[model samples]
Target chain A: SAVISQKPSRDICQRGTSLTIQCQVDSQVTMMFWYRQQPGQSLTLIATANQGSEATYESGFVIDKFPISRPNLTFSTLTVSNMSPEDSSIYLCSVVLPKSGQGGLGGYTFGSGTRLTVV
Target chain B: GIQVEQSPPDLILQEGANSTLRCNFSDSVNNLQWFHQNPWGQLINLFYIPSGTKQNGRLSATTVATERYSLLYISSSQTTDSGVYFCAVLINAGNNRKLIWGLGTSLAVNP
Candidate 1:
């Protein structure tokens, strides 16, 4: 299992401000993703943070609003820009082990999540 | 795009009771996994059953990929088992490698 240390577990921010969440995985991972869990809802994929490349955003998600940075295999960050009330949610970081994840041996790993509230 | 649906929406069970949760996908999936979101908001991997049956302690899961459904079984449930259970799938048909998710089943186990 790859452990992820995510910072700023919870935060209260002003409407115009921005917040950046960080995740540090215990080991190098080829696949890292950012997810958002809306209030009283299920998890939604935000984007796939690729090391040394631009992230691949999902439908209805854009780079300007939810920019991600994967500086290396073990480190990544997602910044919620120009925060608004609608941006408030529980943001999570997830990973997949390339070797073990294949042949049904692999699974997704996740961070504890960062709960954000924009006022 | 794949649609994943989880049943019962919400569930409440007395401690020591057994419960079953199900997940159904709209299309075929080569990978499927069950997760437990604890009260503290941590996503814990419960099972990675893309197919067949697997048991771990008091929890077990079975996935019939051919039929596009999966089941999670919890026996002798405890209050600590109360939380949201989610089924996530990875569809790798052609170039579609996106991970699809279910709305999840919220469980409340009381003492």
Candidate 2:
């Protein structure tokens, strides 16, 4: 299992302002992903951050709106650029654990999440 | 893209009662995971059962990969177990492990 942590557990920001959330893992991970959960909704994948490369975003998401940066294997950041009321959601970071090559398969560990409230 | 469907979108159970949640996938998937969102809005992973069955204390999960379905069993539910349960799956191939999430099952355990 991997231990994940995120900065700014909860923040209240005004509309049109941007906030950068940081995710740090206890150990190195191959892939880091950003997700969003709307009010009373399930999680939706935003992008996959790869170290030394550009992030791959999912449909309905773009780099301009949500810029991601992965400077190393254990750290990444997600910036909600040009925020709006619609962008007020819980953002979480997750990492895939490495397999032990035995009967056990790898799982995902998610951060505590950064809850952003846009007013 | 894979479609995930969870049954009984809302459930209210008494503490100490048992409950079962189900997840159905549209296509073959290489990965299946269950997550619980607490009232504080933290997504806590429950299990990663792509196949077979595994139990952890009062929680157990079973995934029939070939049938494209999974089941999560909660025995002797507690007030702390009241939250939303989500099931996600990775479909197509292994190139991208992008998870498609279900709307989730909201379980409320009343004392």
Candidate 3:
């Protein structure tokens, strides 16, 4: 298990403004992912951040709206550009630990989440 | 893409009762995880049983990879267990680890 933390557990922002959320892990991880959860809905994968490479975004998401930066293996940042009322949701960061052997069991460690409320 | 399904979209259980949640996947996966989201919106990982059974206190999970299904059992439920339980699956294909998430089951434990 890894200890994960997110900054600004929650925040209220005005429309048209942008908010950058930061995620940090206790140890180095190979894979880091961003997710969004709307009220009364399931989790949606936003993108996967890799060190020294451009983030790989999901089909419905783009880099322009959600820019990601991963400068190192243990830290990453996600900025929500041009916030809107619809952008109000919980953003979570997750990391997959490396397995010990081939086809070994591994799980994801997620941050507490950042709750963004856009008015 | 792999499809994941969870049964009993919503459940209400009294304290001290036992319950089981099920997760079914459409394809074979190399990794399977169960998570518990508390009222505070914190996701606590419960199990990483991709092929076997694991137990932690009052919570236990079993995954049958060949059958593409997993079971999560909660014994002696408490009010603190009232929240959503999510099952995530990751299949090993190509060289990428892509995880598919399920809708989750919402459980409410009343005291």
Candidate 4:
């Protein structure tokens, strides 16, 4: 299993400020993603962080509000810009670990998640 | 786009009891996985059953890809099992791949 180390486990930020969450994977992975879990809700995909290229954002999500940077196969960061109280949620970084003896598609592993509270 | 649906929006059980959680997908999937989100917000992978059955300890999962549904069984539940159980499916669209998720079943195992 690939382990992901996420920083700033939880934070309290004022409205309109920006926060960047980071994730470092223990091994190189081809697929890395960012997800948001709103209070008492299901996880929603934010974007796919492509190494050396711009991220692919999901519908209802944009690059302006959520900028992602994947410098390499094992590192990525997600920035929440101009945060608001409604933006308060748990942001998680996930990576897909290729199955053994298979060709690069497997279960997804997630970071511990960053709980952001905007006031 | 694929839709994932989980049944029994919520569940409550006493310790030592057993329960079953289900997941249904609208389209074909390349992979299917079950995850448990602990209270601390860590997603622990429970099973990766695209099809057939697999068991680990008291937890087991069965997926019938042909039927487009999966089931997760937990026996002799413990308080530690109390949390949200999510089912996600991986689907490929042309050159892109995405994992669609279910709303999840909120389970509470009481002591």
Computed on alpha carbons, the lDDT of every model, listed in order, comes to 0.90, 0.91, 0.90, 0.92
Model 3 residue B51 lDDT score: 87
Query: What stretches of model 2 exceed 4 Å from their correct place?
Result: A101-105, B92-94
lDDT of 3 at B26: 95
**What are the TM values for chain B, all candidates?**
0.95, 0.95, 0.95, 0.97
RMSD of 2: 1.6
* Clash pairs, model 1 backbone: A100-A106, A101-A106
Interface RMSD of 3: 1.8
Rank by TM-score, highest first: 4, 2, 1, 3
Tens digit of per-residue lDDT, candidate 3, span B1-111: 799999889999999999999999998888898988888888888888878888888999999999999999999999999999999897764556777889999999999
Q: For candidate 1, what's the RMSD? A: 2.0
RMSD (CA, Å), each prediction = 2.0, 1.6, 2.2, 1.9
Model 4 CA deviation exceeding 4 Å by range: A101-105
Question: Considering every candidate listed, which one attains the maximal lDDT?
Answer: 4
Clashing pairs in 3: none
lDDT of 3 by residue, A10-108 (tens): 999999999999999999987799999998778888999999999989889999999999999999999999999999999999998765565443578
- For model 1, how does the per-residue alpha-carbon lDDT over B36-102 read when each residue is reduced to its tens digit? 9999899998888789998989999999998999999999999999999999998773343667899
